[model samples]
Target chain A: MDLVVAVLFQLIYVIANLALISLGLAIIFGMMRVINLAHGEFLMLGGYTVVVATNAGVNIWIAMLILAPLVVGIVGVIVERLLIRWLYGRMVDTLLATWGLSLLMVGLVTSIFGASTATTVAPPLGAIRIGSYAASGYELFLILITIVLLIAVWLTLRYTKLGLLARGTMQNAEMASALGVSTSRIYMVTFGLGAAVSGLAGGLLAPMTGVLPTIGATYIAKAFITVISGGSAILAGTTAGSVLLGGLNGIFSFIAGSTFGEIALLLAAIVLLRLMPRGITGRFFRKSL
Target chain B: MNSGILRQMRPTFVYALLGIIFMFAAPQVLQLFTIINLTTAIALAVLALSLALIWGYGGILCFGQVAFFGLGAYAYTISAINFGGSTWAILMAVMITSAFAAALGYFIFFGRVSDVYLGVITLTVTLIFFSLIRRTSGPEYKIGNALLGGFNGVSSPPINLPWNPTSFLFPEQVFYVAMAALILCYVFAGWLVNTKFGRVCQAIRENELRAELLGYDTRLYKLGIFTIGAGIAAIGGVLFCNGVGRITPDVFNLYNAALTIIWVIVGGRGTLIGPIGATFALFYLTSALGGQSVLNNNLVLGIILIFFVLLVPKGVAPTIIDWVNARRKKAPGRVRRRRGSRGEGAQ
Candidate 1:
């Protein structure tokens, strides 16, 4: 009974982690139709923000929760204005351009931090005992925070004017413009919001996984898989895709070890994609957002 | 007036002639170290050519091209270690890699996976290969005599004379072979792009639905070109192993994959010669940067990519062709002739 509860907790954490990392990408891709390959780098930059701020004697919580997202969000706005603005509607060009941006970010960060940063930040909140098993209390905290973050995003998108306008712009930019909405400003804000969310996730994860310049490479693939599998619906698709894929990953990892676990996740995604080329949301929740 | 076939073949013939001359003359004029470096670049050029064919001409933007390259290298290393010769190993590598690509492409193209998802899927597959191969460090991961050395990589057998298996080719001889292979592949690709199949592939690239409506099987053509590209890239892997004398899981890394795409982009896609030129140029540029230790190679490459995409989207070859055409039009006789032709056409 204890083992079951422990596994269940771990599984939920996995799903939350997937959802957190993929949400920003989902917003950028789902809303904008701009496949920001640099989404991973935005996460990396967030991680670096935490590291830099913490090193400068800021509180860890403030660094991760506030500074990380703020810094990355500003960078995101700048990027949208400069790079992403021109490449709108050109999908393949966006892919190439953002890929170049990803490389540039990795290079710039590597040069500044010298390959890997010396991170002294460890997971806070200590460990929790789960009968025969002990789990990190920080993991539980992350899970809680992920839920809060998701709720916050859901509320913001649901209740806010910005969210409504952004959705309207995403659905039809010309129509939004015709209705006297500044579609460009919405795009810029939406992109920054996505980057800020990614930053927050990265800042939170930095304690768990040490920040390396090239670490974005590992996250980018998984985020892309989640977002792609999730399809066009921002919140529902991301949640559904994350739960399904992350649950499979967690279960497989528990049973077959990490290597097979990864292979299983990839195989599952490929098969899922084969069956539903437009993705899960494209097929099932055709009306859901 | 030039015949249709001859006109189509003219650029390739000229390039081939220059390549042959350079191949024979390079060893004499260049230092041994430079020749060795050029060998690696030549191998990479073949890989770039494969990408140029599939992504540029076929409009299939595969981000996992290194998977086939790495697989070919591994297959060659394992088979050579087992068979005690490279003659059969090279053939096996190409065949196996192409088969693998064919299977993977079947699922992707036939599944009607969108372009963005296709890129994501291919990249994910490449990462999977990287992570999977990186775990084979254990002693039990041996295939016959060759141990899958995991991240440390395995030393590959050099190509030997077909009759006498004992005598391996030296670095200089290997350089010659690499140059010859590059030239042959370039000519072959040039010939391919003019064929009826290539024309259909280009049409599919332009508009898949239109081609489909015309009764052409877009999926089959994509699969065919993808498999061929994989085969060519595998040959590149074999040559790469011969150049470096080793095979490692690093070949399947995201860096190499990105670098391959960079070569095609910088050199200009949709043209065989452009990527080849870009590969050699960027290869030397990175090597120079490595020597200097002043600027980061990735930063330089990133800037170049951005600059090209924003300013020179047509890439080097097409941009040059456009410039040359503009100059010719500005010439006195050419301007009058062109205007006269336009007037005649209007009439």
Candidate 2:
């Protein structure tokens, strides 16, 4: 049925967006051992930036490409320097501080933007017809862009000086520091990079999901669930978990309804966490941890 | 000579007595609105104490306690209206909420999940509960007395009060009930924390591997504590609905949970009275500032949280206690005697 296919396309879109968010979270949490609760808020800010830029008459795609990483990265750096720097080794402190920060940011945004959902930025005019099914050109472009970014990230991590240093730090911060690498600088930059990636994700998905102050809260749990289940393997695993969650969500929505669909997703993620403690792609990255 | 001991004892008794007296006498003098606000604060304080038990002592940070609060609220609304307008219906609601929390805790903590993941799991559970219940409340919400009233929620039937039972609560009676519950909860928690089970939990927090090596099952303790915490929070939620005479899904929002955590952290995690005092103080401040622009109210709270977290991470209670201890002058030649009595004197 048309409804079924439409739902399926929407599901794919959700998965792709979630994968992008989770991939960045995986790097920040999995690699750096920092739980940035405000990371989602960063995505929120980035999405708003793109929306504002587009409203000012900039080309939508160009606005996203230019503003997302830069704004998020700068915020990330400042946050690292001012707040997160003091919480380097303390997990609980970091959790509390960032939790507070998340609340503060959400409150500020809500006060400024009001509670109503923002109007979504329009997607570019284009549709690609495949057989009898038609898909938005924008959706296809998003998928392709994600794939390209994943590959590019993989290549960079596989072959680059900064990548090697990052890997070393990920394996062991103390040992890496002892090897004469500036662990402090790496931590700041790494956090910034993670935030930037999240921003990029927000910017790209703004057209699909829209720019709302509390929008991040909707996807954050799903993205976190995906990252936890995907294990810290690579972008592939994150994407795989994303599709698994997103597809299941869509299928369940068709059968049981949207509310039940979300409940099922939560239940499934909990079960997966219980069964696969190490996650789907956990084994591959075992040595790195 | 003995005055030092007497001086030290004054604050504890003074606070207790003042709390009791105020509970009885304040409603007589204050406006009706203030009385209502005070009652709400008591409910919120009780809820904060629940967080203190789980996060403070158990070292399990649950970010979704509002789920249980909401469940208890919804359960009470449904049961009270459907079954009967009796106290027993409310009790059943609280029990059901606890049972739900136990089932949730068993699945997450006993599943060998880490602390951070435990928080995420709890958040997911809360979200699921919110989404499902909000949607389901559409049609069958009202089954006789069991009507959910949809998103609007339900309230207790108004009845003639001996002395305005709903609002005034006969002054002393409601306050006594609150005080009794507080004392009972505090004593029970204190005993539990000093028990062998409590020792195992503390050990687990410090070193999970060593605790396991000591033949203690950490996961089971975590689950037990988490369930207890949820139950305690539900107890507070029940009181909250009764005091307010109504309930809504919004009452169980994530903001309430965050506020509870703020109370715990500011009060000093692991300290019982700290959370209680923090809750009361914060509510008092909120009440004072709610008259002003709402943004100013929130800005004040945000600033206080940021300041306390940065400068006094151990929390107001511990910091104050430390300051008081430092201010006391030690008796000359007492160092050796105190050192000898250190283990016993620690408490």
Candidate 3:
């Protein structure tokens, strides 16, 4: 019973992690139709923000919760204004340009901080006991935070004015423009919001994974897989995709090992894509956001 | 009609003549190390050409072309160890890689996967290959006589003289072979783009729905071009391993994949000559940067990519072509002929 409980906790954590990493991409790619290949870099920047801040004697909680996202959100705004705004609707060009941006970020980070940085910050809150098994308290916190984050995103999209305008613009930019909405500014804000969300996820994960410029490469693939498998409904699809893929990954990792687990996740995604190329939400939640 | 045919063939004929001359004359002027570097660059140009063929012409922007490249290198290395020869190994590499691509491409194109999903799936496959190969560093992962050296990579057997397996080609000889292959592949690609099949593929790229309405099997054409491109990249991988005398999991890394796309984009897509020139130019530029250690190569490359994508999206070749065409438009007696040729070229 203890083993089952522990495994379940781990599985939920995995799903939450996937959802957190993918939510920003879900908004940017799913909502805006712009494939930001530099997404992983955005996350990396967030992680670095936390690390740099904490190292400079700032509180860890503040760094991760506030500073990271704020800094990365500003960077995201700059990126949008400088690069992304010019290449809207050109999907392939966006992919190429953002890939270049990713490389540039990696290079700049490497040159500034070297290949790796010494992260003194560790996963906070320590360990928690669950019957015969013990789990990281930080992991539990992460799970809770992910749930809160998802709900917050859902609420904002459902109720907020910015969210409403963003959704309207995404659905029909020309129509929204005729109604006197500044679609360009909406795009900029939405992109920055997505970046900010990504930054927050990166900051949150930093303590567990540590910060490396190259770490983005690892996160980018899984995040993309999650978002692509999630289909078009940003929030609901991301949740569904994450649950399915993350559950498979966690269960397989528990049964076999991490390598096979990863392979299994990728294989499952491939099969899922073959069956439903439009993604899980594309087939199931056709009406839901 | 004869004059039209002659005019059409003139550029290719001149290109072939220049390539042959350069192949023989380059070694005389360059040092051995420079020649070897050129050989590697030529191999990469072949890789770029493969991408140009698919993404540029076929309209399939595959992010994982390096999967086939790495597969080819590994296949060649493994097969060479088994056969104790290079000729059969090269053939095996190309065949195995292309077959794998065909299978994967079938699953992708035939499955009606969207463009974004296609990119993700291909990139995932590449990462899987990278991670899978990296894990095979154990002594138990031996294939035939070759040990999958894991992350350490294996020292590839150099290409031997086809008639004499005991005699390996010197770096100079490899340079000659690489140059010759580049020329042959370039000419072959040029000829292909002018063929009926190529036109259909381009038509499908322009409008898949329209092509389907016209009774063309867009999926089949995509798969065909993708497989052919994979085969060409495999050949490039074989040449690359021959140049460096090694094969590693690094070939399948995301950095290399991005670099390949950068080469194609900076060189210009939709044209054969653009990617080739861009590959050579950027290869040398990075090498120079490495030597100088002034500015970071990735940063420079990133900026170049942004600049080209934003301002010079037509790429160097097409831009040059456009400039020349503008110049010719001012000249008398040739304007009408140029317009006629331009219309045909556009199609």
Candidate 4:
């Protein structure tokens, strides 16, 4: 009974973790249809922001919660303005360019920090005991935070003017422009917001995964699989996809090993994609945002 | 890929001539080490050529091309160890990789997966391979006494003479084999583009819906080119393993996959020789950077990608061709002829 509860808690945390890493990518891809291959780099940058800021003696919470997102958000805006703005609508070109950008980020970070970064930050919360086993209290906090983040995003998209404008622009740019919405500004803002979310997630995960110059490569394929498998709907799709994949991954990791877990996640994604080419939400939740 | 200038002479003839010349001349002038490196570069060029045909011409943006390349390498390595001969191992590698590609492509193309989704699926498949291979370090991962060395990887067998199995080929002989394969591949690709099948593939690339309406099986055509591309990439893998004298799981990495795309993009996608040229240029450029600590290779590559995408979007060969065409038009007779051509409906 104790094992079951602990397993369930870990599974939920795993799902939350997947959602946390993938939300930003889901939003960006869902809105722009421009698959940002540099999404992983953005996450990495956010992780660095926290690491760099904390090393300079800032509070770890503030660094993770605020500075990471802010720094990466600004970087996202700049990247959009400088590189992505010109490549809008050309999906393949955007992917390739961002891939290059990803490599550049890895190289730049490696040069600056060297390969092995001295990670001085640790998970800030104490462990919560589950029967004889103890689970990291930070994981519970992360799960709560992810829930809040999802709710916040949903509220913002459903009720906020900017969200409406952005969604409108995404759906039909010409129509939005005709209705006097500055579509380009929305694109920039949306991209920045997505980057900010990714940054926050990265900062959050850094304590658990640690930071490396080339760590983004590991996260990227997983994030891409989640986002693409989620299909078109942003919040609903990502949530659904992450839960399914992350749950399976957690269960398999517990049962077999991480390798098997990874293999399962990837295999499930491929089969899911083959079954529903447009993704789960693309087929099921055709009306959801 | 008909870079008008390259095609000015019979492309096959020109490729054959150049290939033959380089095959003989390179070993004489270049260092032994450089010749081996050139062989590796030639392997990559063939890989790029495969992409140029499928992505540039067939309009399939395969994000997992190296999947087949790695598969071929693995197949060749394992088979050579088990079969004890390079002759059958090479053939098996090509056949296995092509069959695997065909099977994978069948699911993707026939299932009507959209373009972007196709990229996701292929990439996923490739990552699966990478993940799967990285864990085979245990003795349990063996196929007929050939251990699938996990992270450290296995050393591929040397190519022995067909008649005398005791006499293995030197690096120079491997270089020769690589060059001959590349030239043959180039000539074959040049000839392919002019075929009826290739023409249909191009038409399908231009407008899939239109081609479908015209009663052509676009899926079959895509699968055909994809499978063929995989075969070419497999051969590249064989050459690559031969040149390096080893096979590792790293060949299935995202970096190599992206590098293949970069070569095609920078060298002019629609031109065969362009990517081959780009492969050699970038290959040497990276190697040169590797010898130094002053500059970062990835950063340089990133800047180049951005610069090309922003400015020279048509890539090197086509950009050069356009410039020459512009200059040629400045000649009095050419200018009059061009002007007369444009004079058709001025009013």
DockQ of each: 0.72, 0.47, 0.63, 0.61
- Model 3 misses residue B166 by how many Å? 2.1
Off by over 4 Å in 1: B1-6, B335-347
Model 2 chain A: ten consecutive residues of lowest lDDT: A280-289
Ranking by DockQ: 1, 3, 4, 2
lDDT of 1: 0.86
lDDT of 3 by residue, B1-347 (tens): 24544455456667778889999999999999999988889989999999999988888989998888889889999998889999999999999999999988888888888676788788878888888788888898899899999999999998998857799999999998988888888777766666677778888878999999999999999999999999999989999998998999999988888888888888777877778888999998898898865577777878887888888887887778778878888888776653343322321
Model 4: residues >4 Å from true position, as ranges?
Answer: B1-9, B334-347
Sliding window of 10 residues with minimal summed lDDT for model 1 chain B: B338-347
Docking class of 1: medium
Per model, kept true contacts as a fraction are 0.58, 0.33, 0.47, 0.53
**Which residue pairs show collisions in model 2?**
B81-B145, B82-B145, B82-B146, B141-B148, B142-B147
Q: Report chain A TM-scores, every model.
A: 0.98, 0.89, 0.98, 0.98
What docking class should model 2 receive? acceptable
Worst 10 residues of 3 chain A by lDDT: A112-121
TM-score of each: 0.96, 0.88, 0.96, 0.94
| Model 1, residue A269: C-alpha shift (Å) | 1.5
lDDT of 4 by residue, A105-169 (tens): 88898878887964747999999999988999999999999999999999999899998998899
In angstroms, how far off is B252's CA in candidate 4? Answer: 2.0
Check candidate 1 and list the clashing pairs.
none
Question: How many angstroms is residue A237 displaced in model 4 relative to the true structure, after the best TM-score fit?
Answer: 1.1
Over B73-168, each residue of candidate 2 has an lDDT whose tens digit, in order, gives 667666666654536555776689888888878777767777777776777677566555555466564656555665666775422233332443
